[model samples]
Target: MQTSVTFKNIDPSDHLKSYVQDKLNRFDRFLDNPAEASVVLSVEKFRHIAEVNITGDRLKINGREETNDMYSAIDMVMDKLEKQIKKNKEKIRERRGSRGAVKASPMVGFADTLAEEDAEGEIVVTTIDYKPMDAEEAVMQLDLIDDSFLVFTNAKTDEVNVVYRRNDGHYGLIQPIR
Candidate 1:
Protein backbone atom coordinates (compact mmCIF):
# COMPACT_ATOMS: atom_id res chain seq x y z
CA MET A 1 0.00 0.00 0.00
CA GLN A 2 1.19 3.52 -0.86
CA THR A 3 0.03 6.38 1.30
CA SER A 4 0.26 10.15 0.81
CA VAL A 5 -0.79 12.53 3.51
CA THR A 6 -1.56 16.22 3.15
CA PHE A 7 -1.76 18.68 6.00
CA LYS A 8 -3.97 21.74 5.91
CA ASN A 9 -3.94 24.62 8.39
CA ILE A 10 -1.59 22.65 10.55
CA ASP A 11 2.15 22.11 10.79
CA PRO A 12 3.46 18.98 9.09
CA SER A 13 4.43 16.48 11.71
CA ASP A 14 6.21 13.18 11.28
CA HIS A 15 4.30 11.88 14.21
CA LEU A 16 0.93 12.56 12.57
CA LYS A 17 1.94 11.08 9.25
CA SER A 18 3.29 8.00 10.96
CA TYR A 19 0.08 7.71 12.90
CA VAL A 20 -1.96 7.69 9.72
CA GLN A 21 0.40 5.28 8.02
CA ASP A 22 0.24 2.84 10.87
CA LYS A 23 -3.53 2.93 10.87
CA LEU A 24 -3.76 2.40 7.13
CA ASN A 25 -1.27 -0.46 7.19
CA ARG A 26 -3.79 -2.57 9.05
CA PHE A 27 -6.00 -2.45 5.97
CA ASP A 28 -3.40 -4.26 3.90
CA ARG A 29 -4.91 -7.55 4.98
CA PHE A 30 -8.12 -6.52 3.27
CA LEU A 31 -6.77 -5.09 0.04
CA ASP A 32 -4.92 -6.61 -2.91
CA ASN A 33 -2.17 -5.28 -5.11
CA PRO A 34 -1.57 -1.65 -6.03
CA ALA A 35 -3.50 -0.17 -3.19
CA GLU A 36 -3.09 3.60 -2.77
CA ALA A 37 -4.32 5.85 -0.03
CA SER A 38 -4.72 9.64 -0.12
CA VAL A 39 -5.21 11.18 3.28
CA VAL A 40 -5.88 14.86 4.04
CA LEU A 41 -5.73 16.11 7.59
CA SER A 42 -7.03 19.58 8.29
CA VAL A 43 -7.94 21.67 11.26
CA GLU A 44 -10.63 24.27 11.61
CA LYS A 45 -11.21 26.52 14.58
CA PHE A 46 -12.64 23.71 16.62
CA ARG A 47 -12.80 20.72 14.30
CA HIS A 48 -10.08 18.41 13.21
CA ILE A 49 -11.05 16.87 9.89
CA ALA A 50 -9.66 13.79 8.24
CA GLU A 51 -10.47 12.79 4.68
CA VAL A 52 -9.33 9.49 3.31
CA ASN A 53 -9.70 7.85 -0.05
CA ILE A 54 -8.50 4.30 -0.62
CA THR A 55 -8.29 2.67 -4.02
CA GLY A 56 -7.42 -0.97 -4.39
CA ASP A 57 -8.68 -4.41 -5.33
CA ARG A 58 -11.25 -2.96 -7.70
CA LEU A 59 -12.69 -0.91 -4.93
CA LYS A 60 -12.65 2.80 -4.15
CA ILE A 61 -13.74 3.73 -0.67
CA ASN A 62 -13.84 7.24 0.79
CA GLY A 63 -14.33 8.17 4.40
CA ARG A 64 -14.32 11.55 6.15
CA GLU A 65 -14.49 12.34 9.82
CA GLU A 66 -14.31 15.44 11.99
CA THR A 67 -13.67 15.61 15.70
CA ASN A 68 -12.21 17.78 18.35
CA ASP A 69 -8.89 15.97 18.25
CA MET A 70 -6.80 14.99 15.23
CA TYR A 71 -6.21 11.51 16.52
CA SER A 72 -9.88 11.07 17.16
CA ALA A 73 -10.75 12.20 13.69
CA ILE A 74 -8.29 9.78 12.15
CA ASP A 75 -9.60 6.93 14.20
CA MET A 76 -13.18 7.69 13.26
CA VAL A 77 -12.37 7.89 9.59
CA MET A 78 -10.40 4.67 9.70
CA ASP A 79 -13.32 2.91 11.31
CA LYS A 80 -15.62 4.20 8.61
CA LEU A 81 -13.29 3.02 5.88
CA GLU A 82 -13.02 -0.41 7.46
CA LYS A 83 -16.77 -0.80 7.58
CA GLN A 84 -17.06 0.16 3.95
CA ILE A 85 -14.40 -2.30 2.95
CA LYS A 86 -16.05 -5.10 4.86
CA LYS A 87 -19.48 -4.33 3.47
CA ASN A 88 -18.19 -4.20 -0.09
CA LYS A 89 -16.23 -7.40 0.33
CA GLU A 90 -19.26 -9.13 1.77
CA LYS A 91 -21.40 -8.02 -1.13
CA ILE A 92 -18.85 -9.29 -3.60
CA ARG A 93 -18.62 -12.60 -1.78
CA GLU A 94 -22.36 -13.02 -1.91
CA ARG A 95 -22.42 -12.20 -5.58
CA ARG A 96 -19.61 -14.60 -6.24
CA GLY A 97 -21.42 -17.38 -4.43
CA SER A 98 -24.18 -17.12 -7.01
CA ARG A 99 -21.87 -16.38 -9.89
CA GLY A 100 -24.08 -17.71 -12.61
CA ALA A 101 -26.93 -15.48 -11.60
CA VAL A 102 -24.70 -12.40 -11.43
CA LYS A 103 -21.46 -12.90 -13.27
CA ALA A 104 -20.47 -9.26 -13.42
CA SER A 105 -20.67 -6.30 -11.15
CA PRO A 106 -22.79 -3.70 -12.86
CA MET A 107 -21.32 -1.38 -15.45
CA VAL A 108 -21.28 1.41 -12.96
CA GLY A 109 -20.39 4.74 -14.58
CA PHE A 110 -21.26 7.41 -12.11
CA ALA A 111 -24.60 5.69 -11.50
CA ASP A 112 -25.86 5.72 -15.07
CA THR A 113 -28.07 2.84 -16.18
CA LEU A 114 -27.12 0.46 -18.92
CA ALA A 115 -28.80 0.58 -22.28
CA GLU A 116 -31.95 -1.43 -22.57
CA GLU A 117 -32.22 -4.35 -24.95
CA ASP A 118 -35.38 -5.14 -26.77
CA ALA A 119 -37.14 -8.48 -26.43
CA GLU A 120 -35.69 -9.52 -29.76
CA GLY A 121 -32.20 -8.59 -28.50
CA GLU A 122 -31.92 -5.42 -30.47
CA ILE A 123 -29.13 -3.15 -29.29
CA VAL A 124 -29.82 0.18 -27.66
CA VAL A 125 -27.31 2.90 -26.88
CA THR A 126 -26.91 4.37 -23.45
CA THR A 127 -24.95 7.50 -22.66
CA ILE A 128 -22.66 7.57 -19.64
CA ASP A 129 -20.32 10.03 -18.03
CA TYR A 130 -16.85 9.04 -19.16
CA LYS A 131 -14.12 9.79 -16.68
CA PRO A 132 -10.38 9.29 -17.06
CA MET A 133 -9.30 6.61 -14.61
CA ASP A 134 -7.07 3.57 -14.47
CA ALA A 135 -8.17 0.01 -15.14
CA GLU A 136 -8.42 -0.71 -11.45
CA GLU A 137 -10.64 2.29 -10.98
CA ALA A 138 -12.79 1.14 -13.85
CA VAL A 139 -13.11 -2.30 -12.31
CA MET A 140 -13.97 -0.76 -8.97
CA GLN A 141 -16.57 1.38 -10.67
CA LEU A 142 -17.94 -1.69 -12.37
CA ASP A 143 -18.12 -3.60 -9.10
CA LEU A 144 -20.59 -1.14 -7.65
CA ILE A 145 -23.12 -1.41 -10.44
CA ASP A 146 -25.30 -4.15 -11.91
CA ASP A 147 -24.12 -3.92 -15.51
CA SER A 148 -21.66 -6.42 -16.90
CA PHE A 149 -19.35 -3.95 -18.65
CA LEU A 150 -18.05 -0.41 -18.36
CA VAL A 151 -16.69 1.91 -21.04
CA PHE A 152 -14.29 4.53 -19.74
CA THR A 153 -11.38 6.65 -20.81
CA ASN A 154 -8.07 5.26 -19.67
CA ALA A 155 -6.17 7.85 -17.75
CA LYS A 156 -2.82 6.36 -18.62
CA THR A 157 -3.44 5.88 -22.35
CA ASP A 158 -5.92 8.67 -22.94
CA GLU A 159 -8.00 6.27 -24.99
CA VAL A 160 -11.32 4.61 -24.57
CA ASN A 161 -11.40 1.15 -23.08
CA VAL A 162 -13.97 -1.36 -22.03
CA VAL A 163 -13.92 -3.36 -18.80
CA TYR A 164 -16.31 -6.15 -18.24
CA ARG A 165 -16.92 -8.70 -15.56
CA ARG A 166 -16.18 -12.24 -16.60
CA ASN A 167 -18.17 -15.34 -15.84
CA ASP A 168 -15.26 -16.86 -14.01
CA GLY A 169 -15.24 -14.16 -11.33
CA HIS A 170 -12.52 -12.09 -12.97
CA TYR A 171 -12.49 -9.04 -15.22
CA GLY A 172 -11.82 -8.57 -18.92
CA LEU A 173 -10.58 -5.43 -20.64
CA ILE A 174 -11.10 -4.41 -24.25
CA GLN A 175 -9.05 -1.67 -25.82
CA PRO A 176 -8.96 -0.31 -29.32
CA ILE A 177 -6.06 -1.06 -31.61
CA ARG A 178 -4.30 2.20 -32.33
Candidate 2:
Protein backbone atom coordinates (compact mmCIF):
# COMPACT_ATOMS: atom_id res chain seq x y z
CA MET A 1 0.00 0.00 0.00
CA GLN A 2 1.12 3.52 -0.77
CA THR A 3 0.60 5.92 2.14
CA SER A 4 0.88 9.66 2.61
CA VAL A 5 0.78 11.20 6.03
CA THR A 6 0.08 14.86 6.72
CA PHE A 7 0.44 16.64 10.02
CA LYS A 8 -1.62 19.60 11.18
CA ASN A 9 -1.03 21.78 14.23
CA ILE A 10 1.92 19.61 15.06
CA ASP A 11 5.53 19.31 13.92
CA PRO A 12 6.23 16.58 11.37
CA SER A 13 8.08 13.66 12.86
CA ASP A 14 9.67 10.68 11.15
CA HIS A 15 8.66 8.49 14.05
CA LEU A 16 4.98 9.24 13.51
CA LYS A 17 5.26 8.59 9.79
CA SER A 18 6.94 5.23 10.33
CA TYR A 19 4.35 4.33 12.94
CA VAL A 20 1.49 5.05 10.57
CA GLN A 21 3.11 3.14 7.73
CA ASP A 22 3.60 0.09 9.91
CA LYS A 23 -0.02 0.26 11.03
CA LEU A 24 -1.41 0.64 7.52
CA ASN A 25 0.58 -2.34 6.29
CA ARG A 26 -1.79 -4.61 8.15
CA PHE A 27 -4.55 -3.70 5.72
CA ASP A 28 -2.76 -5.27 2.77
CA ARG A 29 -4.25 -8.68 3.58
CA PHE A 30 -7.75 -7.36 2.94
CA LEU A 31 -7.04 -5.89 -0.49
CA ASP A 32 -6.27 -7.78 -3.66
CA ASN A 33 -4.76 -4.79 -5.50
CA PRO A 34 -2.44 -2.09 -4.36
CA ALA A 35 -4.15 0.70 -2.43
CA GLU A 36 -3.39 4.34 -1.71
CA ALA A 37 -3.97 5.66 1.78
CA SER A 38 -4.00 9.28 2.87
CA VAL A 39 -3.70 9.96 6.57
CA VAL A 40 -4.08 13.18 8.49
CA LEU A 41 -3.02 13.63 12.09
CA SER A 42 -3.88 16.75 14.02
CA VAL A 43 -3.84 17.95 17.58
CA GLU A 44 -6.24 20.53 18.89
CA LYS A 45 -6.04 21.42 22.59
CA PHE A 46 -6.82 18.17 24.36
CA ARG A 47 -8.09 16.26 21.36
CA HIS A 48 -5.87 14.28 19.03
CA ILE A 49 -7.57 13.60 15.72
CA ALA A 50 -6.79 11.06 13.03
CA GLU A 51 -8.34 10.70 9.60
CA VAL A 52 -7.68 8.08 6.95
CA ASN A 53 -8.82 7.78 3.35
CA ILE A 54 -8.16 4.61 1.36
CA THR A 55 -8.90 4.09 -2.31
CA GLY A 56 -8.37 1.01 -4.45
CA ASP A 57 -10.01 -1.75 -6.44
CA ARG A 58 -13.20 0.19 -7.15
CA LEU A 59 -13.60 0.97 -3.46
CA LYS A 60 -13.08 4.10 -1.38
CA ILE A 61 -13.15 4.08 2.41
CA ASN A 62 -12.80 6.86 4.96
CA GLY A 63 -12.61 6.97 8.74
CA ARG A 64 -12.04 9.62 11.40
CA GLU A 65 -11.38 9.35 15.10
CA GLU A 66 -10.47 11.65 17.99
CA THR A 67 -8.94 10.69 21.28
CA ASN A 68 -6.66 11.96 24.00
CA ASP A 69 -3.76 10.02 22.56
CA MET A 70 -2.63 10.26 18.98
CA TYR A 71 -1.66 6.61 18.76
CA SER A 72 -4.99 5.45 20.11
CA ALA A 73 -6.80 7.74 17.68
CA ILE A 74 -4.99 6.20 14.74
CA ASP A 75 -5.66 2.71 16.00
CA MET A 76 -9.37 3.41 16.43
CA VAL A 77 -9.76 5.00 13.02
CA MET A 78 -7.96 2.09 11.37
CA ASP A 79 -10.27 -0.30 13.13
CA LYS A 80 -13.26 1.54 11.77
CA LEU A 81 -11.87 1.42 8.25
CA GLU A 82 -11.12 -2.28 8.59
CA LYS A 83 -14.71 -3.01 9.56
CA GLN A 84 -16.00 -1.13 6.52
CA ILE A 85 -13.67 -3.01 4.20
CA LYS A 86 -14.70 -6.35 5.66
CA LYS A 87 -18.38 -5.50 5.30
CA ASN A 88 -17.95 -4.47 1.66
CA LYS A 89 -15.99 -7.65 0.91
CA GLU A 90 -18.76 -9.75 2.41
CA LYS A 91 -21.35 -7.90 0.36
CA ILE A 92 -19.46 -8.65 -2.84
CA ARG A 93 -19.15 -12.32 -1.94
CA GLU A 94 -22.82 -12.58 -1.07
CA ARG A 95 -23.80 -11.03 -4.35
CA ARG A 96 -21.72 -13.46 -6.37
CA GLY A 97 -22.41 -16.58 -4.30
CA SER A 98 -26.17 -16.24 -4.64
CA ARG A 99 -26.20 -15.72 -8.38
CA GLY A 100 -27.41 -19.24 -9.20
CA ALA A 101 -29.87 -19.62 -6.31
CA VAL A 102 -33.60 -19.59 -7.00
CA LYS A 103 -36.00 -17.72 -4.81
CA ALA A 104 -39.80 -17.38 -4.43
CA SER A 105 -41.38 -13.97 -4.59
CA PRO A 106 -43.74 -12.73 -1.89
CA MET A 107 -47.00 -10.76 -2.26
CA VAL A 108 -46.54 -7.03 -1.79
CA GLY A 109 -48.81 -4.14 -2.71
CA PHE A 110 -49.52 -0.59 -1.69
CA ALA A 111 -53.13 0.13 -0.76
CA ASP A 112 -54.59 3.42 -1.91
CA THR A 113 -57.69 4.30 0.10
CA LEU A 114 -59.34 7.54 -0.85
CA ALA A 115 -61.63 8.92 1.82
CA GLU A 116 -63.04 12.31 2.68
CA GLU A 117 -60.23 14.24 4.33
CA ASP A 118 -58.73 17.68 4.54
CA ALA A 119 -57.04 18.93 1.40
CA GLU A 120 -53.89 19.60 3.34
CA GLY A 121 -53.38 15.90 4.09
CA GLU A 122 -52.93 13.74 1.03
CA ILE A 123 -50.73 10.87 -0.07
CA VAL A 124 -48.49 11.49 -3.03
CA VAL A 125 -47.57 8.48 -5.14
CA THR A 126 -44.65 8.56 -7.51
CA THR A 127 -43.79 5.90 -10.07
CA ILE A 128 -40.19 5.06 -10.69
CA ASP A 129 -38.43 2.98 -13.31
CA TYR A 130 -36.61 0.44 -11.17
CA LYS A 131 -33.77 -1.32 -12.95
CA PRO A 132 -32.45 -4.77 -12.13
CA MET A 133 -29.23 -4.63 -10.11
CA ASP A 134 -27.31 -6.48 -7.44
CA ALA A 135 -27.54 -5.44 -3.80
CA GLU A 136 -24.10 -3.85 -3.86
CA GLU A 137 -25.02 -1.83 -6.95
CA ALA A 138 -28.24 -0.80 -5.25
CA VAL A 139 -26.18 0.55 -2.37
CA MET A 140 -24.07 2.62 -4.74
CA GLN A 141 -27.22 4.02 -6.28
CA LEU A 142 -28.59 4.84 -2.83
CA ASP A 143 -25.43 6.80 -2.05
CA LEU A 144 -25.70 8.79 -5.28
CA ILE A 145 -29.38 9.68 -4.83
CA ASP A 146 -30.91 11.75 -2.02
CA ASP A 147 -33.72 9.28 -1.41
CA SER A 148 -33.76 7.36 1.86
CA PHE A 149 -34.85 4.15 0.16
CA LEU A 150 -34.35 2.50 -3.25
CA VAL A 151 -36.41 -0.19 -4.99
CA PHE A 152 -34.77 -2.40 -7.59
CA THR A 153 -35.09 -5.86 -9.06
CA ASN A 154 -32.47 -8.26 -7.77
CA ALA A 155 -30.20 -9.32 -10.63
CA LYS A 156 -29.49 -12.69 -9.10
CA THR A 157 -32.93 -13.83 -7.90
CA ASP A 158 -35.13 -11.85 -10.31
CA GLU A 159 -37.11 -10.45 -7.38
CA VAL A 160 -37.79 -6.89 -6.35
CA ASN A 161 -35.70 -5.68 -3.41
CA VAL A 162 -35.65 -2.58 -1.28
CA VAL A 163 -32.49 -0.96 0.11
CA TYR A 164 -33.02 1.65 2.75
CA ARG A 165 -30.85 3.84 4.93
CA ARG A 166 -31.29 2.94 8.56
CA ASN A 167 -31.39 5.35 11.50
CA ASP A 168 -27.99 4.13 12.65
CA GLY A 169 -26.20 5.32 9.52
CA HIS A 170 -26.15 1.81 8.02
CA TYR A 171 -28.05 0.19 5.15
CA GLY A 172 -30.87 -2.33 5.38
CA LEU A 173 -32.00 -4.72 2.64
CA ILE A 174 -35.56 -5.97 2.42
CA GLN A 175 -36.37 -9.11 0.42
CA PRO A 176 -39.41 -11.24 0.18
CA ILE A 177 -39.41 -14.73 1.69
CA ARG A 178 -41.96 -17.48 1.14
Model 2, span 37-79: residue lDDT tens: 9999999999999999999977999999999999999999989
Model 1 lDDT, full chain set: 0.85
Model 1: per-residue Cα lDDT over 15-60, one tens digit each: 9999999999999987756799999999999999999999989999
Which residue pairs collide, candidate 2? Answer: none
Off by over 4 Å in 1: 100-178
Task: Give lDDT: candidate 1, residue 166.
Answer: 94
Q: How much lDDT does each candidate structure score?
A: 0.85, 0.83
Per-model TM values vs. the true structure: 0.56, 0.56
Off-target runs (Cα >4 Å) in candidate 2 are 100-178
